[model samples]
Target: MAITIKHHIPGRVRFSLAVLKQYRDLEDWIKQSLIAIQGIKQVRVNSHAGSIAIEYDAQILTEETIKQRVAALDFEQGEAKETEHQYTRGDVAMNAIGTLAAVLLPSRWGAMTTATLIAPTLIEGVNELKDKRLSVEVLDAIAVGLSAWRGDYSTAMMTQSLISFGEYMEQRTSRNSDQLLAELMQPAETMVWKLNDNQSVQVHSSSLIEGDLIELKPGDAIPIDGTIIKGAALINQSALTGENVPVRREEDAVIYSGTSVHEGNILVRVDKVGSEATTAKIAQLIYDSLSSKSEIQQVTQDMANRRVKITLGIGAAVFALTQDVNRLASVFLVDYSCALKLSTPVTFKSIMYRAAQNGILLKGGSAIEKLGQIDTCVFDKTGTLTYGDMQVTDVVPLDGTNDARGLLAIAASVEEHSNHPLSQAIVNAAQDNQLPHIAHGEVEYIIAHGLKSTLNQHCLNMGSRHFLEEHENVDFSPFEAEIKALEQQGRHLIFIAHQKRLIGMIGLRDQLREDVVDTLSQLRASGIKQLIMISGDSQYKAQMLGDELALDKVYAQATPESKSRIIEQLKQAGHKVMFVGDGVNDAPALTQADVGIAMQNGTELARQAADVVLLKDQLYAVAEARTLANIAMKLINSNIKLTEYINSGIMLAAALGWLTPATSALLHNGTTIGILARSLAAKHAK
Candidate 1:
């Protein structure tokens, strides 16, 4: 295959593979081949564009080397690697042709033709039996084989036709559900502004390397784990911290991949790229979760396998008692294998599809099963329960010179020059009141402290109380009583000083999510027995929020390790804990709990550790997910009962000679198809 290098950079290159335009199926093989090479981090194939993009470690492989490797690839070898298990139109067409042949040909010839069509199924059953396992395939083979031995070619052919079609449909449904989930987990390719030669140039994120300076503006997701080196920004770390509020990241502050800039601009020096990036690691974790099977899935499969053996014994007993081959064939045709084996997973897939549509990503059937069983709900206070953004709650003027609005306007004027969350909050409050900006001297930002400017020739200071009192020599003794009152109320105060005298204090607090009360109420109503809250806030603040929400218990000043310990203790004390958290600190607790539910804006690691991730930024989705799980489990159980009772009745009728081999086959297959339809229909169930 001829390869043309369309673009090239240090760690990345895009090649035009014109052959992909004609042979699109070879794309996966080509990607796999490149990924197998040493130093290659990622490969993306665009068949439509006939391009293959590769990101590799430049230290190990050069652009010239990658180009040579691509040119040397063999298209014929790639074609040979295609998956054999993939269903095609030919599979369905072959089954249809065999059924038509069985119906149109002479009896002996028709039997031979149908037998050839079912040979693979029989071989599969034999393989299972050789391994000491009786499966649905075994039951299916026996039913078709007995009918043929009784000289009923048409019945055998029809049964095999139905089995082939059902199996195909099951595969297609499973594949579609898995594809939907895979699509959801795929990361969107991003481009970032890199500072090359002091000029900003847009480049693909994959091409970034350590020490490269990348500029980020409002709404741009940070594509690499790095430290901000220039400027400041209010970064929305909800994706990493699960907090609704954006935090200020200034010079030297570490910023992680998956977080976004909410306001302002910053230049970050990349420290991690490609698969080593935080979001990429999370994506890998999510991919691993897709194949995991729940205990319920295993249990249902075991039950189905056991029923196959029981069905074979029933057929044996019926034949021995009556010495009737026809009756035995009828009994064999009525086995519970088909409905019992297929419906549980079908139901789980259906519910998963529905959950995804409703802004919830249930990792697998295991997540759904565990979520349904969760009794004690543990919540992290900061990001999970409270809104991420802080709101200005109190604006007090101490000098008796400025009203609340004047004090707010003055603070906003200076704060607007910085990108801190508190500064933004004050600025936003002033904007809401339509207050004009107070003209002041050039603002000076004191990192981790506050802001300083000149208003009417006297120095104006606005920041932490410690910054004003200890550093700026501003006396706050007169407002000690007022500050303590606000502190006791869980208010974060921003002190303002002019001419070394305390002038005002602005109080900001994280607002509780409006839906939190209703969400907690719904959780309790939906069988969550103990509602607990964990927080990094002071004991007084944590307890205050706990009381407001009526939480059963509150753990204050919790570290990441302590959070996990609390979850472990809860589980040890006989509770099925569902931990809801959003921060990097919450990752341990998220993993420790029986079920971890990550908020939509939660950190990448937290989401990866979580079983259920809410795609919508809503606290109520937790309750919705719990309800959906209960509904899914209920649907699966009901399906099991329906399969058992219906198949048992059909089997008894077959044994008593109430149904012929053909009729028994039709009824049994119809019952299986009906149960499958009911399971798939659960996607629409409330």
Candidate 2:
């Protein structure tokens, strides 16, 4: 089906109403199909809007070509429905009745009737043989064929009925799971207030078109991508940017779909609508992450494939040597392919769902497996361990001005232009005290140091002790004892200097997360042997925090590059490290670690670079993620082992002639389904 091109850019195309319910595994199937196309870079399906977005090289795949290919593509939902119909209650009942009828009827007539009823299985088996594929269908066909030829019509009918039931159950289970995932992917619909001139109209979000003006009130979700045309509000963009806090948005600010307006009012001029929104792109990225297979999955698949081929060869060889059709059927039916292939994906995807519910988005199965193996965890101290919510605890005037508000007002004026957390904190504290903005001349911001500006025609410098005392040669001896005392309490200090002389200091305390200590203890208990912290704070402050957390190592006054080097060094020393951070500065270290976990409220750079993201902004999520990972790995390994053992027993029983081909097929199918059910039914730990 050709989908409507809702929006198009040089490398991206958003297709509306593109998803079909008939495709049971829509996300993965669409991804696999489109990703193989010559120029296609990626594909994301939004099941909620029934739309898909594709990023591709336009030079190779033209818009016309994409449309034609999409229209021509076929998915197997119809085929699955047909299969489901064949195994419905009515079919099962008829099959059971036929088996009974065949047993009670005359010998020749019963055999002939049974043969006719089991013809589809024989045909499928012949097709498998022609395709050079080993399949359980062939084994079922052989068992039914041999029994009918031997005039054991009851055995043929009963075996075919049982095999049909098992296949139905397996397919039904998988189909139901696919439906659940699709439902979860479905986006929730909401009403958007569109502004046509001075009038407001309430309409569905999907009905919104480009160039339309929309008004967002307090507690309203921004349903379309747009730029603010008027008014201002505190917008929560956590869903889009992984930021746990809401940001103030005013005129000219870009607002995205799925983010909400927390306060005030705003008029947004829509630029992107429907599937073209940023939320849709994120959904696509997430789908791509989860659908991609891990190395373990590929290895398991290879092993299963090899085993199937070997089993088929063994069956053929045994049949040629002994001329035993029943034995050959038994060997073919007892192979381990189904259990291995079905269980692994169920386990992986199920865990993905569980993690999503608990506020973690695992990039893929590989991340889950890698997380389980993490032995050392490195944390960025500022925004990661602490709440990143800095507050003005104490303000001291060194020049005996006794004007805390005046000092804060001066500091806020110099720091208001910075996007740094600490800078914002100072500005916020000043705002809380209702200090009016002071006029300041052009400001010079020194990277990772301080900002120098002309306030009241005097050279005003505001920053760290190093920036004031060492860099600017400002005297801090008068407040050295107070600085030492505050540093010991893990409070961050920002000094204010006027006319090249220290005048005041602001003591900001970034409180640790409520759950950090407990979560750290949990991680240690869960096999995280080494806990390390890296911070840009002074040695005294970093040491204080490290001591409080009881970390294994602390690297204070570390630069961004040094943080990455520390991760590399730990990795070189034979430790699987997971780095957690929340700022853009931590991006390098995050990438360098074995697994990078970005906080939900972290910068976009950190979120994009990290392998996993914590959506709840909770430090305890680290422990939760680790626990889930360990559980997933354990479940996968145990399921594989159990399947192998069960299949082995079936093979042995069949070879010894202690179990009939029919009975062996039932047992094998039962084992496979049982394992899959357990994988799907696993309860997630809190």
Candidate 3:
């Protein structure tokens, strides 16, 4: 297994800077490497002047290829003589200054080099978008600019621009913050493993770190990775593991350093320090997640455009009213979207992490956003809704064989080790009947089909209708009508046979979820327009379940891809849809929907793919989220209205000579805080 990098898919670019061994030595080499690809397998890695860079096409050059090429370089073999360049502090600062100069131009004015300097910065400070006072795009630009500004100031190149000592200090601090996050985001370290036939790992950590024997108090950051030497506590690791509530950790429970201690205090032995800590990776993921685009990217894009126009229009109107461009420029400092933008993604991620604590995994922000807009939910039933658990309900013997149990018994013995939930159920059912299970049979596993196995030298097979037909044995046309009658009532038919002889048929009924009917009704009552059921079960059983749940639409016998297609179909027809599923089988549909929701106890894949994960598997969680969203949007709209009313009224007063430009500037900035506070009121509403 190799991880495929999907960096060049239009809107995305993947870039990395090398982690220099003697990082302090070569700043210029790092800067030069930034312009091109940095070859790999480097051990005694020396840095460039300041940063390492990669060419755009490097994504196409897989890591494996680079590893091969870098291995061949043999840096020490040639007594390797290569020219090393040197630069003074002023030279480095001047070069960086030149780069930032070109990058200052707006998106429409720059070239590729400008993008290299600015793009990463834009990605870094994307959270500023939450400041509604500014446009999302303007925020992005400012973020990029701030980074460039910091870089220039750090190298002492910003002296020309900073007219005062105060400005220089501000520029320096901003640079420090930028560099801090960048240094902390070094690529994840990989570990090699050796295992015997047993699946368990002998030891987990590779190295040990010594720290002051500090007792971790409740609500404290772990500070180091360690095994539980003493004590226990419920750890609320929303910051690290994304769990809403704290998870309980007892003695002998290994606690990763950096995850917070939510409640109880404990003694832990430090295992790893610094970068190797789990908290570091969590922080990196948080940063990357903020940088990446969510599903409703339109909100940010539109906000960005609106800010630019609002600023332009406001600047003119303010100039006419107060006759002071300087005061007008001060209005530009208010970014009202900061709280809104940053909180949305952060809140969504927190929800995902909470879901993980409840045993669900939602892939990313995009999926979470999609889950919020859902109206019509589509589901893949067998594994998703139904527990995918099966049990033999009936045994129908055919072809004059009075021994149907014998064949089922033989088949179940061989399939005991199969991973399918259904197979496990069958084996358990056979054992319950005290049926003799003969082992030592060769079994063949088939995808999308039933398995074939030899029992006591007699060929036996079991699976779906198509698989049975392929074997050309077990011709059950005579009993087909009876089977259809049974299936109409929600019974599943599994054919068991021995080469050309129909031995018996096993009927299984997957138990319905205890709360499914109530869940569906609650969602519909919450204003969900359509409840569509997607299942691989027979049409008869599918319709039966739909009727039981009062679902408006039902798609029976669908594959995973088909579930996603159904979601797209509803969206195309102009309805917002939310899909609720509980297993990996529903991952595709979860990703495809407007809002994908998972039950509290859903599979990791389904949870990760969903936008909102239901904490308790109750449909009410969906209702809670819908109501929350409704209120959030309302607050957002109200904030805008208040801002507009205040600005327009203030401008009128300024124009009539009642207010000075300086006074207008102060009031305009002051009212922003008040408006935001009033907007926050809706956050607590029902």
lDDT of each: 0.79, 0.75, 0.52
lDDT rank order: 1, 2, 3
Which candidate number maximizes lDDT?
1
> What digit string (tens of lDDT, one per residue) describes model 2 on residues 1-686?
64788998888888776456445445555654455454566666655566778877777667666666666556653122112122555555666777887879888778767877788888987987899876555565666677777676777777777666655554444444333333333233566667876766767887878999987664455767899999878876765566645799889989887676655667899997654454433444444565568877887787787777767787778778878878877776676876777677777767777877787777778888899999999999887899887888988888876489989898897787554678879999998989988888866656567688897798989988777877889987777798888777777888888889888889999878999999999999999999999988988778878998899999988877899999999999999999999875677788889899988777654665677888787999989889888988899999989988999888877776677766876787678778877777653444
| 10 residues in a row with least lDDT, candidate 2 | 77-86
Per-residue accuracy of model 3 over 91-172 as CA lDDT, tens digit each:
4354356446554744333344444444533543354355544453354355235333434222111211121222222223
Q: Candidate 2, clashing residue pairs?
A: 48-187, 242-600, 243-601, 244-601
Superior by lDDT: candidate 1 or candidate 2: 1
- Arranged by TM-score, best first: 2, 1, 3
lDDT of 1 by residue, 1-686 (tens): 77789999899999998887776667556654555454666767777688988888898778887787778677775543332133445676787787788778888788778878778778877887898877887888788877777778788878887776676767666655655565555343477778999866778987888889988765466778899998988876654455656799899999887666665678899997654555433333333444467888888888988898899899999989999888899998986767777887887888888888899888888989999999999999866898655799999999899999999999998887654456778888998999997889867766546788999988999887668988999988888899889879898788899999999999989888889999999999989999999986667878888998899999986777899999999999999999999865677799789999988777554666688988898999999999889988898888889989999999999899899999999899888888888888878776
TM-score for all models, in order of appearance: 0.69, 0.70, 0.54
Measured by TM-score, how close is model 3 to the native structure?
0.54
Which residues of candidate 1, in runs, are more than 4 Å off? Answer: 1-101, 130-132, 188-212, 215-287, 394-480, 488-506
lDDT of candidate model 1 versus the reference: 0.79
